[model samples]
Target: MEESEELQSILSYLPLLMRSSSLFWPSQAVETLRELGGGRVDSGYLLFQAISHLRNALSLSSEPLSPSTALGYALFFDEVMSGEESRKWFREVVPVLGNLLLRLPSLLETHYQNPHNSMRTATALRLLDSQLPGIIFLSQELIAALLGCSFFCLFPVKDRYVNHLPVINFDELFASLYEDYNQKQENKIWCIIHYFQRISSNMPKGIVSFERKVLHLKNDYTHISCPDANFWSTSTVPLCRVEVHNSGLIEDQSSDAVEVDFANKYLGGGALGRGCVQEEIRFMVSPELIAGMLFLPAMADNEAIEIVGVERFSSYTGYASSFRFSGDYVDEREVDDLGRRKTRIVAIDALCSPGMRQYRTNFLLREINKAFCGFLYQCKYQLYQKKLQDNGCSSALFDAATSTSMETSEGKFSDHKTTNSQNDYHSMDQGNNIGVATGNWGCGAFGGDPEVKTIIQWLAASQALRPFISYYTFGLEALQSLDEVAHWILSQRWTVGDLWNMLVEYSTSRSKGETNVGFLHWLLPSIYGHDEVIQTQLHCVSCSETDKRVVGMEAYLCGLLAHQHRYGLVDYSNYWMLCVALRPFISYYTFGLEALQSLDEVAHWILSQRWTVGDLWNMLVEYSTSRSKGETNVGFLHWLLPSIYGHGTGMDFSNLA
Candidate 1:
């Protein structure tokens, strides 16, 4: 047959073999073809025909093929060939493989991108990474030959380019691998460290870089000499000298001239009395100066300064010079006698600037006063509440009796008698103890229908008593109320600290305790003017604790009392009064809206607070400007301006600002 006819004939049977479910037939047929082609005079021709058949079969097969099938076929060809014959077979097979690969991009675009295909992209990449290594190694020459073909011949440019790619540098590949490995290792180490710290009280110190020595010295400062010094002795020698001249003019000279040779008098290399000039003679300084010079030597050459008796002084020339004292001695006070004597010590007082002392004292006094006032305020609130409870029982009883009788009474005559008797006695009692009756006496009426009233009061007192509830039934109910408020606040970019502070202030300032009642009345004209204690109760309901509901509630109450005094309503509170009050607000707000606001308000608030297109654009600008550091306070401004303009007012940014 002609070459074209031969190729066509081979291709016809290829599809049938490739699609056959019986792998045994295809393997045996491939083996028979390989053996027959090996002896043919036109071996290349027969091999090429066989390879073309396989390629055609691969292309035409309608049945879905597993990766194992492709692997099996490749392995079969590899096992049947050797040397030149193997090269020839690989060369013929690669073009078909290249053609197959060329179809991948299109296949990916269609099969992978199509939502219906649902191909696992990661699995595909992993498979490629795994299979490419073997293909590149086994058919290196054939793949290289195919790469040299025209881009449009049988395969696309991308396929040919990838197939014939050379081995990447081992160093670069290893570097990448090492980096990835190191990062994973570090992550594991960090995870171990965190686990140990979290799960155990005692943790190994190996993970931490702690100094074991007392000083934890990074460098040997005590022994190292100055870099300028020739040796340890040279660095340690004092630079100052006192000399008494023949003219009786005492003058100071640089001690740099006092070399190690001159300082080491014990060497005895020169005779002490030889060529001595008595007229120009002068006594050397004290031995203490010489003793101060001895120290351990530094090992490093650059560590010369470390050996110096004192830290090297700053100078333009890089060498430190010592200060000197020079003066002519009086006739009675002999210069030799002064030189022989020990250096007199001078005692001096530590001097401080007037402004510094004043500022220090002022800060100290302020802190002390603040602490004292805080203590006094706490005591006063406690005493006040105790006294109110003790004295207000009579009025509370009167109110409770009146309320109960009104609800249960049958007729006007009975009601009149009850009212007249109670009122006549109340009027007379009120005349005498009006202050006590009006203040503390009212709390006894707090308990109405213990269940219903408690629930309502609890609902109303959410901010105050929420932290104290042992049962979560009310909290679950409250959560529905808190959702809108929390979403509104958290959706904004306020820092936790700023948000926390604001909630604290609002809760504290609006409490309804007796002391805060006066301020609540004052602020009533401005806003809702709700009772401070009730407002505090509402804020407390927002706390996020799981079991300490009662603690949270009492904290809220104490915070309310503290805040009232802090704002001058109670006369002795500290600056942190508002901060304390707002603590519950932050906690509860985080718990979600069920603890705070009604569903309607929450939904409306959340919808209204949604970021608008303009706001997003502004945020982009703000983010960009912040990255470039073009503006100092853009973040704060973004938060504050919108807040002041009522952007998040319904959610309450007043205290935060």
Candidate 2:
């Protein structure tokens, strides 16, 4: 009965094995084939060894498959040796097996046409990072399934992962593996050869070639502070807050690329985007200067690169998709302390695309710029202005590339979203780049998502080795929230490093599809200590201890009140007022009031007159009418907070009318 049950289980796995499950243990087969190629296994042992590996890999996959998958090849083995007539036919396969094992990449390459060839594609994609193993054996069904496809696929292998493959002459291995078991057969050998040639011809150029880029940031006076907060709101308009040029096409109006006899820094697209800007600058700038930005250092998430004092040799018109070359103009820009033009170009890569399962950070295998040019270049203005406010650094004329991709994801910082156009690969081919023709090329600073741009610049400041970097943010209400959060962390006595670690954790976790993660979510578990005030029988001490444990919503409010009570806020009753005053627009989350009661808080905020009196009256009437909770309505609050706290109730709506 047990044997019959096992057989039934084996039958269940047969279809999955035949279909080429991506989870299968081709690695074991890979190892066995390599061993066979080492000449340790003789001819008679070849078929048996290959069959053993296939079975082992399947069983180890933890998915149930039929036992026949591993053992059935032995049955065929016996038949090949059944008589002299069969022996000749079987002998043809022995030498071919060894050669095929050595040419695994080409074998995988040939299998691209299979509809269910993800494993083959996966294997091929990992070819640069993995060693080629010998003699991969799946069931005959699996083998046939792989060899049946005919399509084109080339997964881009970034520069960072190419060191794993052994350096060998693939052409020789492929040539040696091409022997037809029955080469004399006109029909069999010719068709196989023709197919091999076709697949080999489709190989992409520089498929596994990549190199590192290097550019240095002078530590004149700046040190990169991790997770740029940019929290300070300056009373005076910052250089970043306004554009100096009169025209939207200021870049075009600037000294023509040819007329600007010299510059110290010029911005470019990126090293990975064919270094488009740098490539164009080559027409006017020195080739040596252009080469400096080439192959710069790798950026981790939220990192920025600044190439200082690179002279812009040419000027152009149009933005992305519609970019064009216009006539050159003369550059009259002043020199800096180092006597280099105060020109700077920055590279800021987007973290990750929306909804991608992987976060791009130091953990990424390969990284390139996305659409973060908006925040990156804008922040450069902020930094450059800051640097000027302090002092200046030495020479410029270098290049910069963002170290990693840190997309402005809405994981820990609030669910902020960018409304950039969707990225389509065929944009250029379809002529969709120039839609109406009068668009801007600049990745204008992220005006809508204040938190994203602030965090990005602040984080870059933390990691950079520049002379001066500022973390002041002009994030309106968001900045106030962060300031309060910082105070809360201080009250908790948590270190800045610990908070940075959590920031990294939240960034990575969210990018990788982790859910229920917030910047402060981890703090929740820590807040709940021990989970016990355990005592079965009631007593004075126990009852007192139970009282000490605050579990209700009121307990949380009381605790928070006590914590803020110590902040020396003069009028603690006006806590809501202070929050509303500092941040022009207030969310319930401004002080954890939203979680307590959205409607009640909104009503109270209006009656407090922290906002306009009209808004309070309007919302109060709306809430009174909706839920009939008129006790907490605006009129009651007018007497409770506003009227009592010095606000005059609007008896006349003359201005509003």
Q: Of the candidates shown, which would achieve the greatest lDDT relative to the real structure?
A: 2
What TM-score, computed on C-alpha atoms, does each candidate reach? Answer: 0.12, 0.27
Q: Would you list the C-alpha lDDT of every candidate in the order shown? A: 0.22, 0.28
- Write one digit per residue (lDDT tens) for candidate 2, span 617-647: 3433444565474444344444334444356
Task: Write the residue-wise lDDT of candidate 1 on 1-657 in tens digits.
Answer: 122321232222212221221111244334433443343312333433443343343442332222233232333234323456446434444334333333333332232233212211111111111111100001112212222121111111222123322111111111222333333222222221222222122211110000000111133323111121111112111111111111211112121110111111111111111111110011111111111111111111111010001111111111012112122221121111112111111000011122223123232222212111111111112222344366675354323323222213222122221122212211211111000000010011221111221121211111111111111222223222232333333333222223323323332443423223222222211122224434533332121212222222222212211111212222111222232223331211212323222323332333355432223234344556675876544343334234433566423333211
In Å, residue 473's CA in model 2 sits off its true spot by: 18
Tell me how far the alpha carbon of residue 159 in candidate 1 is from the true structure, in angstroms, after superposition.
22
The ten-residue window of minimal lDDT in model 2 covers: 428-437
